[model samples]
Target: MNGLCLVTGANGHLGNTLVRALLGQGHRVRAGVRDIGNHAPFAGLDCELVYAELLDSSALDKALEGVQVLFQVAAVFKHWARNPEAEIVEPNLVGTRRVLEAASRAGVQRVVYVSSVAAVGHDGTALDETHWNTESENAYYKSKILSEQAAWQCAEALGLNMVSVLPSAMVGPNAGSLTDTMGFLQTVRQRQMPFDPGFRFNFVDVRDVADGMIRAAEKGRAGQRYILANVRSSPLSDLIAAANTHTPGYRQPVSAPRWLLLGVAWLQERWARCVGKPAQLLLSQVRLFHNVAQEYDITKAKNELGFNPRSPEVALQQAFAYLYRQAHQPYEDLPQAAVQTVSSSRA
Candidate 1:
């Protein structure tokens, strides 16, 4: 836990924050990225930047050299792509295998595979690490499930010590690009979403997830998985209300029935396919909202890894502030009165 740590996808939202966390803990880090020329994200950070394309064995070898811990965080996380098999699933599945194999070959002491709650299914009850998402049709969810499975298989085969951490919908500051979850929040804030489909999500701050990953590397049982998410699921309305409280004046979209939303999503997908672009509203997402419960049981993580996360409302407020700053808008801190109002409403 003391030697050089290599973080793949180091410029990503979670990866960047993880690197900062490691650095703050007085650990040397080798930031692995696809484009070494894009140093803007690592500006002023004292870490070695290496090119690490997950599929490239030579690149992985070079990046993993002398690294005691490896955080495999790179993946193609897209819900709707031109070809899900090629753009999403293949990279996630194959890339995970390649990274684990390379880490084993390079003699990395510990590996923390960054998985998602999408891999852990729900059944109208709070899900734990024991649950597996066996019914998701979403490409992104499928990729996470397959990739994590591959990671464990490869680790066991290679005798490598690896731990998997499944984080729920992550939202926090220092996002280099707008991820799908962040895009959803942005759409809601801008009133671009036509209506709320009553979707629920287990939200967590990216920083808390990063800390949880570190804990996994330090003390997690080999081949075990931990759920790093909020203790409870929150409705989309809660997120909207939080945004309204922090940054008011955006009109709220009316709630729509599930069937109506599904129909609209189908039409949107058709139009998107005809235009050769990614659909803003995916049918898989609608189906998931209708089927799976987003609640989670983080007791294992809490007791084992000492994972303590802030409230989802606080995460939403930070995300809203970050998004507003990204747009060059003046964002004032949530007033004490507004905070009281929002807290009372939630209670």
Candidate 2:
């Protein structure tokens, strides 16, 4: 309860929120940013910024000094960058190892690992802590699965306390003025969705995720993993409708045929490989689109960590409304395809 904490990837959307939450809780935070020169994100907040990379064991050791809890939440999307090994895997896995090793040596009390539902989900259907993703798909999922495995193994071997929080698609407002989901929501508000948003996925507010990590540090059992799933998940279609509530006539998810999604995936891979970037619709995202459904069993979190999130409809509204306010627009004429939009062909 009374020790300095450290968070990696402090410049990212989730990282920023976690940093703020830790500060609000009056915990001393040692924030590790890949780029220390850009001190702007941690500005006006009480935190320490250091240049730390996962591959650099010495640097990681330096940052972990005196840190009692380590919140490992840095993530990378393969499709967004040219090389996943350097961008996605190295920092994620190696960085995680460094943190865990340093924490073990420093005798840190707890480590709250922010893993993805993708790590525990496959063929979807609301997997639990017992399930794990198949490695035949995206490198991002592979990296997370591997990272969690390493963390767990290290926890067992070194007697380092660890708790893993597998969260759903994080759709919430963030610092740096952008979120990965913003593009999808923009598509919905501007009536630009080429396909229907008929899918279903759970929601866990980033704020809730932050709280869950704190809970994991305090009350979570060592060597345990918890799925931070929400109470409800909005139907993809209803999600679009929610956007229309504030925008006053937003487009909704159009049914993009299953086959069409496949074609998109194929094209996405080709395009990404050609340009040396990650495929936007990598196999895991597509598989998730096809497999993810059903309510996650979060009784463990509720009973143990006291984790609860707003309903799916409420969470989606929070996400879109925050994005809209930040954009200063009425959800009209969005410049990107973030979500499905109502077409001029709408009834």
Which is the leading candidate under lDDT? Answer: 1
In candidate 1, what are the lDDT values of residues 93-150, reduced to their tens digit? Answer: 9999999999998999999999998899765588899989886588898999888988
lDDT of each: 0.84, 0.72
What's the TM-score of each model vs. the native? Answer: 0.92, 0.86
lDDT of 1: 0.84
- Best prediction by TM-score: 1
At residue 229, candidate 1 shows an lDDT of 94
lDDT of model number 2:
0.72
Instruction: Output the TM-score of candidate 2.
Output: 0.86
The stretch of ten residues in a row with the least summed lDDT in candidate 1 is 338-347
List RMSD in Å for every model shown.
8.8, 9.1
TM-score of 1: 0.92
**For candidate 2, which ten residues in a row score worst on lDDT?**
338-347
Model 2, span 1-347: residue lDDT tens: 68988888877777888888898989988877667766556656767777656666667777777888988876663435556677777667876777778778878888898888768764434456887777635667778888888888888888887889988777775646455455666666667767762457676677788888888889998888898867556566767767877877655545766677778877987798788765646544665565346457788888999988777777778887877776774323323322211111111
